[model samples]
Target: MKPGPVIRIDFRGGIVSPGDLYNILVAAGRLGLRRASFGLRQQMFLEVDDSIRNALCVELDALGIDYVNNLEGFPNIVSSFPAEEIFITRSWLSEGVYKDIFDAFDFRPRLKVNISDANQSFTPMLTGNINWVAAPGSPHYWHCFIRFPKTNIIYEAPVCAYTNDLASITACLEDQLMKGEMNGDALFGHPAMAHYLWKKAEAHLELPPFNLPYYEGLNRYGNKNWLGIYTREEWLSIDFLKSICRLCLETRIGQFCITPWKSIMIKSIEDADRPRWNALLDQFRINMRHAANELNFQVEDQNPDALALKIFLLKKLNRDDIRTFGICFGIKTRPRSEVFCNILIRRRAMIRLGRWSFWYRYDICCSEEFNPNKRTAWVFSRNNPRWLLPEQLRRAIIAYYDGKSIAASQQVEQSNRQPDKTAVQQIHQCGECLSVYDDPETSFGDLPAQYQCAVCDAPKDAFVPREWEKQSA
Candidate 1:
């Protein structure tokens, strides 16, 4: 497969029974593994020796465990498992709802799929090819966003309702894309085709406002307590894992969730069981209360080198007392790595400066709103050394968000004194699609007379100026 001795086991929506994980750990131990790692997609990963690969595979199959060795044709379905009870959600998207939705999927999606609460930032909203966000207006409906495979272009689908409808729509879309029946760009152009698909998938549409809630540490939900555990070292010891699993089973906790931050979260701890859980933690010498700054980071799984770099950067930031509140960081070690963070520290291509030695550079980029979900455009600070990333990111985060807040406040204050007349500008926009042409750089002045939108390729004539702009003209 790709010259690796690793096996990946996906737990669908990051919801795994403690007993199942314990069994997997037992199997891994038999394969001479002492530790197991969790992926950003909430999948379990274990590094095994090549000599025992066959034996391990047979044993896993016998145990009815689903796994992949060095190939990821079907990516794991990601969800906001970390937000279940810890964060505020607009609607009741319970564990049962997640389970029902996951069980309905009969086919493995070729593209990444994400089911998340729009109100929570613990799970990325737009990183998936098919992003199903919980609609705030209704508990049964979801706002769907279709991000074209291998591209940043995203198209909003009609609000989807019913678990069966979600399954059918996902299957149909995957089939259409895989069989070359329709492409992402062409899907928006053909109204009849889009109408047929919508007709087949019936749902009412209601827009939802996006809100991100901070997720970390011990939190209370109802009367019970939930604990979030993070480790600087990515690997969780098998013994510690087993102990926790036993505790979960004894306490009657049904599930254990893995977050994209490579942390484990245990929810629904009984008030009486808190002392026992704390004692177990003391016995295992596990630390749950890591600093908030240290908790929000994304690194490539199974890469010790990247982990080392992250530790180094975090230490540097801590030493400097940099304020990273409400901000998350992502380190991109591999080429073209997709990250879900406000600030990104990307590794540039290695340069062959000489035969004996090579040089590398790092690029720093931050989202316009310092929000991963609103990653419309990245403000780049290119060609920097690896060591400069921490300071560069710190400065960029402050400059971008700070300036944006100031400008926003100024606009609001000015609007309070005078009417907002900027809407009178002759800007062209698409009603059917999420495409807008307001920026002077991308306005009609810069394009040919017959130019069309890059997303839906709608003709210039299709975009009509607003009534206010028409009156002003």
Candidate 2:
């Protein structure tokens, strides 16, 4: 929907082995798509126009890849494997558990499915239409939450399903929900129920508080180190990904886990291989450790303008040192997107009297109890101008804490404050990866006309003058 036909490649349970990923990348490179981005559902995607849509589809078809063209069809099956052995240390949930459930699926699911660890809040519990949350048990039990089709109503299953029955339960439930007017007691009456083993579910799951772990950078857990990579531009260079796949194969790493946050993580990383990863990141000019709050927001998938707005708001929040530790933000620029987050900043058409007279504003709302799993929404700010969003969101953050949010007075000053010249300096920045030329002795203009970015090989014109600007309005 965003200027080009989006090709989505589902990574079954957000798990892809190095060899399989490498092949896909090689094919994409042959098709002239040099960059790729992951989706919120832990799916890989690339933007292709009419010029090569047919060829790309053919290439994927030839490889027997599972994909959705033009963003239509059943969504990817996402799981919390990225958080296993890292964010969640004491959970019964493990990679093997997730893989077994994924492998048991005999048919393509009609509904979006999520297999998440209940102890870890990183992957979220209720994003999928049919969710199987890993609960505590010796053999492991899963709590099922079904969000009926075409409605926000989520019905928790009366009983906890056995681990072996997860796949069949989800598939059957998806089929039942698709028949329409099928919910509540009618669900338990399905003839398929006789084959599954289930126990009474807890009256309530006292889940962990919403605290997103700092997933970026090389983190140590057990004897292995894991690496999490995120890009503010929401796109990874094909070359960088290829390098990753090659490095993983050389290092004997099994697979790469894609997170619901639109990032990639490689687990079971050898300590000796840490230096190689460091070099890989350096070669790509990839920044590993962004501010924790910077990683908290989720922009609508494939929306560059929404990402730009998110960058602006994050800059303002960092400048003011606002505490957004437990909060997650979701920006919805398009209607009907089901992005899950604690605070949702939604773009709305304000006034459209005629073709020439159209205005747009934003509405900020917070989920009940600051939990994205709940659909209840409470308005924080409404009818705010585009430029005043930072100020509005600042108040919303205040509201998130202690429910004491100050009013964003419109009568307050509104102007583009000039950048701090002393604190910031102009420099040549690579457009591809945002890497700046920072040689003290030699200016960027002194470089040859044919000089490319040392990191990404972007052309000379691709290196634009980067300047800092103040928080406007």
Candidate 3:
């Protein structure tokens, strides 16, 4: 099906005033737009018919709303605004701080930049080229990680960054990188450059461990309330979105935030406005409470095939009563798409099956320690039929995590029994499929004489055992 031209409306730092949204919705309605999508970088996407394209652009311009069509020279700056009340966050990284940071940026960043709270998981901290995470124990200081262009390697700055200095520091780094004067690694290594950056941006850098928090559903935040809304249908009706915008204006909610989880979050809802929000939800027949498994998924925007597959998988998982708590999943229909999820379900490049028709296989991977940021060591599953991937991923993830827990506990018990020793154990994993052959519940010796991997159907002989040294606790 042919879709219209994409119009991107950047909500700087993921914050958009209710009045602004309402005006845009009105413009969209006038242009006969039925639906809109939210981007991972907290921007709005609308497909406009060519006939009304110029008219819509004129309207948006008159309203002073910044928008671009089919061009992405500048990427929207992402932040943890959506995670404020819905997810656990540091006290100092409040809405005011976020707004101040967004306002301080005088120049648009060509590279992706993410400003997130290290304690929260709703927003990815490492996906941005210039990643800034709020430093623990330092109120307004941020830890910066610069990901070199076209590379996965991340380099940390020598010191923490002040909120006011973020824009200038980022601009300087980008200029230096683009000019080929220094790389991320060399920027920190060169004494002169290091001294210059430190002098220009004064602060001490202390990077903390990142933990992704579970973010879903209607949650209370002090006297105020916050709501997280999701839909399996992929697109929310324009009418419904407009209604919510009107409600926000009426309740003086000020702004709405879009989460990376492909959902809408409205924070600072007054206790008195609870009934109004409830009435709006009831009128639209919206269900705020979805299973955690259903809520923690990311699908590529505007991809119907991927969205359909996600719905299918979620249904199957729910039917099987699988416990997928504390995990997030992403389905990428396009190759090399940057989506933040603990587990990834990727579609293999389409293979020509005759001339007119093509066939596709799926590969699945779980991030190290279930962290999306550390995707360097991806253990992939063999290619499988598209329809069978749901069950395969479910089994693979459960077994992987379960075996990991058991291995940890076994090491702990062994260490207690023999205080002065370490144990090395051997296990097999397929090099092609990356499926581990070790499971505490299943013994390799008990397998049939000729057994193959359940995932890729590779021969048992293909499995190679590798030893891992487990230290005594």
In terms of lDDT, which candidate is strongest? 2
TM-score of candidate 1 relative to the true fold: 0.81
Task: Give me the runs in candidate 2 sitting further than 4 Å from their true place.
Answer: 352-357, 404-473
Judge candidate 2 at residue 177 and give its lDDT: 81
Q: For all candidates, what are the clash counts?
A: 0, 0, 3
Write candidate 3's Cα lDDT for 3-90 as tens digits. 4578888888888888898899899888899888887788888887789889989999999998878536588899887877566544
Clash pairs for candidate 3: 159-205, 160-204, 160-205
CA lDDT of each candidate? 0.71, 0.80, 0.74
- Candidate 2, pairs of clashing residues: none
For residue 211, model 2's alpha carbon misses the true position, in angstroms, by: 0.3
Best by TM-score: 2
How big is the positional error of residue 100 in model 1, measured in Å on the Cα after superposition? 0.8
RMSD of 2: 16.6
lDDT of 1 by residue, 1-473 (tens): 12257888888888899999888888878778888778888888888888988888988898898888863557889998667767755457877788889998887788788988756666887888778887655665676777766455667764354554677667766666565533554653444334333322245333232333444456678999987777778778888888889999998998999887777889999888889878887897877667777777787777776677788888988898887766777777665457677777766544445443246677666654565675524435655787777778778767856866887898777755744444445556654333455444344666667554333335667666654443211
Which regions of candidate 1 deviate over 4 angstroms?
1-4, 179-218, 350-357, 414-473
